[model samples]
Target: MFGWRRRNRTGRKTGRSKKQQFKLDKESVLPNHFRCPISLDLMKDPVTLSSGITYDRESIEKWLEDGNFTCPVTNQVLRSFDRIPNHILRKMIQEWCQENQNSGVERIPTPKVPVTGTEVYEILSSIEASMKRLDQCGFLESLKKINKWGFESERNRKCIVDNGTATTLANAFVTFSSDDHHQSLESHNYNVLEEILSSLNWMFPLENDARKILGSKPSLNKLVLLMKRRDFLSTKNAILVVEELCYDQEFIEALVGIEEVQEVLVRFIKEPICHAITKASLMVIFSMVSSSNHDHERIKTQFAEMGLVTLVLNMLIDGEKHLNEIALGVFDRILDSKEGREAACGNDLTMPVLVKKILRVSELATEYSVSSIWKLSRIEKQSNEGRVLFEALQVGAFQKLVLLLQCGCGDSTKEKATQLLKLLNPYRAGLECIESSDFKNLKRSF
Candidate 1:
């Protein structure tokens, strides 16, 4: 009886071990066929099958929509919904569906919410508050103190290299230069004027105080002298300050106006600094006369007859790209004045050289070279200077136009170029030049 019982017990244990091994094999094999092609994740949530089939909720749906769907590993066609013939797999999916339903889980798409007027107002308010806090922060105060010291000690040379003072000075110079009130503040008490000049290198931590001082009329001459003595290297900053002083309506109405400022600026333009600052100063002077309410022909003619046009044109020929833009702007403004244009024409200085520069600029525009092209074209349009426009087309401007045409791109530059070309009648001269040149091969590359 004991021997018989031992045999039965051993047989039962062996049978149970075989059943466990079969279950493991089934689980491993099931995943190999059911893996998703896109993510290679174990297939769930509306799983499809092979044989042009789809099986959702144990119901066969025929002719599943055709796309790139296939087996992830073997890349076989998944044709029909009934392709997953494994009964265990179907039972498992049905069980999962029932569980999800019982748990009350519903998959709903999220709706997007749009911002209202109130939300927009709140956002802007937050930004303004943050900016106010940043403006009054301790670091800004330290920067102001350092720049004050730099300007007082005549350490302009060293201050430019020190990033903190340089940035502060740049901001202060731009702010003071743009403020009408600051120009008025300059004509106030001498002590206040001195303080303002000394602290010119510092950022204005107090915007209201700075604005008030700048708007007031102080001695601009004294400020200019101080800046010259300090050897401030930034010409752009210096020119802006000078512009504010030159164009101050109340200050211009006073005795010390464009006449006095012009003499000082012309001297500065002759100084050995970056050409851009000098060019900018020239533009400011031209703009002052052009936009002035005062009858400043005497001043304008004085500037034009002083060989200013020659100086500006020379700078345009050799100046860097940014300076080129300013030089072009100055030329355009000068041409706008009948007195200035007559003066330029009387000197026999208007055409060929200036026109050549415009043409060269047009060629550069095709390559999307610089922002200066738009300004240059604007000047070209205003001046009605067509000789150089024709000359530019004769010298391969048409080839650039053709190349741009093939690319089928439209921008301000291409549009301007096309308009300029139309005025010049490029087909007669420019088209001939292009046909004679090797532009045919170049166009093929496009």
Candidate 2:
């Protein structure tokens, strides 16, 4: 009886194994036409079937849960869960899940978004279209509006400041000061400048326009009123604006039309402690000086005779290391002109005094003083009174030159010293004096 029971159990196990083998053979027999086109590895994530349909693992699971499991291949609709053949579907799902989990990513479908290229092009095209509509009159009107707005803004800023508002006023004066408007205006197209300037006036005020507003009698009256109040800051701003205007060829021509502009500027220069004002004034003067058509000699004579030489010399004396270059440049300009040269080398006493000052400065070992002295000696017109100049240079000046030569200060300084020595040693005065020294022991030491 035990043998019969064991045989019966073996027979059941054999039948179950045969059924499983049959299902595996059926699945393996399916054609390759059912494969997905994308990966070509087995159909996995969101696999598409031969019926032009795609199903994720979730969709297939839902179909099975609803008792609708079918291959649609053999029309073999499965009834029992046991009859449903496992087709490595779980393996594919496991692989996709592991890939996503390892990468820490989730698959998302792309959303449809509209293109903006055409809209951007349309906006740019509209700007290009409107550029043609800008005419001279329209431009002038726009400029006027700009000027009005600027004036209002300035007034508002002042009002805010008065009321102790936290808003900071725009530094209009500083902006005007810093701008390289002279170069900009010269390079800019005139029509564009006219438009820009007109726009500026409309926004700010006509107070700054030296040609249009300041050139007029009423504007001059208003400026005189502001000037009388000793509002130097505002005066400075006005001068800057005028200087920029003076840089403009057309504006300069208009200024030449009215003698009042020059008169006002000249009067301003005459005032005491007008260094800041003088800077702007000098720009205008320099502009005129640079012109080929202008009579520069007359201006040079005028400035020289007006004590400008003394003022500039005093400036040089007071100027520290930083202003040395400017002072030297000013000295050079003064010495270049005949009137300036005369003023500097004039009074027989001035050259000696200058020579002494140069010696003192050189002894202090200021490079700028040494350089300036070297330059002055080269340009100075020699006279019988050069004896005093020679004496001043001789006392310790030669020692300074030797020191510079030893240090290799510069070729120019060495060359200058050589030239100066040659000048001083006319008729072998220096060499004869040196040879006469009791050098019996000195020669032996060498």
- The number of the candidate with the highest lDDT is 1
Q: Model 1 over residues 219-308: C-alpha lDDT tens digits? A: 343445333443444334445444544444544444235235566566555563656457557656656555555555666566665556
1-446 per-residue lDDT for model 2 (tens digits) = 34333235445333335556665654464334333333323333343343334444334544555666564334455444332222455354444445655344232322112113343244324423333453334434433433343354443323322321111111222222223244332322223333333333222323333245344433333333333334565556555545555555544544444434444554554563466566665555444433333554555565566655555555444434443343434444445466766676543333332433443443333343454455455555354446434543434455555555676655655676666556555533552222211222221100
lDDT score for residue 320 of model 2: 47
TM-score of candidate 1 on Cα atoms, chains taken together: 0.40
Count of backbone clashes, every candidate in sequence? 27, 8
CA error at residue 85 for candidate 2, angstroms = 60
CA lDDT scores, all candidates in order: 0.44, 0.42
Give the residue spans of candidate 1 off by over 4 A: 1-198, 204-212, 215-217, 224-240, 243-258, 274-283, 286-302, 342-419, 426-446
For candidate 2, give the lDDT of residue 445: 8
